[model samples]
Target: MASSSGLLPSEPRTLPSTGFQVVDASETIEEETLPGYHLGKYYPVRLGEIFDKRYRVVGKLGYGTTSTVWLAHDSVESRYVALKLYVANLNNTRELKAYECLDEADEKDHPGKTLIRKLLGSFQVDSHSSNGSSSHLCLVHEPLGPSLKEILDLMPPYSFHLGFLRPVLRNILIAVDFLHARAGIIHSDLQIANFICDVRSSDKAMFAKFENAEFTQPTPRKIISEEHIIYTSRRMSLSKALPLLCDFGETRLFSEAGTPGEDIMPNVYKAPEVIMHMEWDYKVDVWNVAMVVWHSLTGRPLFNGRSADGKIQDDRIHMAEMVALMGPPPLRFLERSTRMTRALWNEDGNWKNVAPIPDITLEKLGADINGYDKEGFFLFFRRMLRWLPEDRPTCEELVYDPWLMRELGLGLGR
Candidate 1:
């Protein structure tokens, strides 16, 4: 949230992406401080540190491979904000551009569309630490609550009302549409963790509904870890519980001529195009979001690709599962995946390198998909889980699909 106090708003905020932060070739590390935080070179920012000359860090929100987010008070604007600081080496100018495009848009610009988190501002700061002189890019954003993954962890593994999922799915679809069609960006990473609950939703009943809910706490890492604080929907209520898309580091603007790296999305939510190393577009986001909706509704993954031994099956296994459940991959896609020809398939378009994994069919995954319009639910799935990316519906189409419509009480399709 941009502060109304006018500190940053008072200044000329636009700046170029270059300058500062030299890397020494001889530098090496023997030990690291923060675990689960190995994505980039971390800056040793102590608590209560003033950032970008204005915002004061209050608490750490969360940390990821590339950056660490904090709950900050923008003293200049006199408003709370989400402050994301990225390590110097990551160089996330692409993500910065994505937010710049979104900054020009608002919910009012698109009538009846769902809301997405807004980026307030961004600036770079140079810090000299024991690790060396590093330049960090700090982005200011509207504050959001815990993630869907955190929310789910707060509940019993299977405890959630099916009806509670409709708004979330709708909201996510709206954000995806905004990213794909409006912003010309693809959310290369789409997972439960990337969806933050709107902490300031005005819906009282929505917040009240989860008052009695339990939030799972993280295990002991450092004694000062945020895990020590138990967060219920009520206690950590930054505002409301409306779900919104967050995290743009992994996002990329899609184009026909440009071919992004094949390994773009998370393993669990990867699209078939990504699996087969095809030049993909917005369709990958559709595949990812379908799985997200499924998990949100059922509290179980659409594809539980890992076994009891914690061995997540390889891509060949994943491809076999997808093929068994959704039928064969498109012939062109199979032919294009020649890199894995010996390990995944044969000349006959049949599985050769992988054995069939049991209980992976759509019927099997949807067995517990009751207490709602089951047929309509599968209809949405079929439209989304297509073998060919070109054949899948766009975000605009899926948002109005009969299944979403039924859940939204807008009537069913044939």
Candidate 2:
């Protein structure tokens, strides 16, 4: 029984009590007064409001610097969907174009397709307030559960067991492979936050329960003024635990190879080629996968890229760490970036003492792994962590690596 204006049935003439708690204006709520936050920039979304004449807002999911995400019920499809509303006047053409590329790709039969989050639809909404009118871009997507980072936070050890980590890694590699080989897209930003868990079964029931709770026990909020209200975000329960690669805002379309000198990726996960300002390609993503594996298994970052005080990131320190762990860059490799080579190394290709290289090795860092599988694990890392991008294995090759598939009973007798 969908209403003409929305999916849910019409509300009663006399609305029921919301039972919402109001907070003082001075109290901080979700995304209130954060950097870049301004009135008329973000669309003032109200609970129970229907957008695009169909999807009804259930509750706030979360907010980022550029956008706010909400859980909504799609009346036409009779299912729950997530709505990402970008700040007014923000340029989101890159992300939209990436989705368009994915939609046009002829890889429907690819197994990795299911591991990537699907974009449902998109539209523009005009907001009118006392200040002015602004148009916001809204993207509709399939609802998902918590991110891998959030899940890790709940774990006491903040790390995943090998059994749990294996499948997640395999699925991520498959998804990356699909993006590279089929879509010709490179997801430049790959991190724990972008790896979200999928909500597969019992989705309807779960969303319905969430909507009902919003009606009976509304989320607390702080009303700043007549036009601004900050509501606390509601967290969804864990789902089937399948990892989906998300966030295409930084994705680049590659026809043959990547464009050099383009700054991408978080500082900590940056590849050597990226650090040296040299040509990079899909292998940069291979380097990212290695860092992710190290973080997930060790519960700590392998590279912090920090200065002496650790208050800011310094490339010299970061490069020095790589030297300590992987040894000096080959002269052939140094020739790729003459400027960086001159700054960090002597003419004879020896360390110029720009920064003190730490005394460390991969074996010492990963010594905590059990004796039986330690060798295999480091071997897998060596295949991807090479200073030369060409030396690193591709996502497809790493998917079949002996270490990742050893306990899963895959890649046997190879």
List the candidate 2 regions with Cα displacement exceeding 4 Å: 1-24, 27-29, 32-35, 367-372, 411-414
TM-score of every model versus the real structure: 0.79, 0.90
lDDT of 1 by residue, 201-303 (tens): 3432222222112112221122223222211112344335677788887777766322734678777788877766667787888899887877765677776
Once model 2 is optimally superposed onto the true structure by TM-score, how far is the C-alpha of residue 160 displaced, in angstroms? 0.8
Name the TM-score of candidate 1.
0.79
Best lDDT among the predictions, by candidate number: 2
Q: What is the lDDT of residue 402 in candidate 1?
A: 71
List lDDT for all candidates, in order. 0.65, 0.80
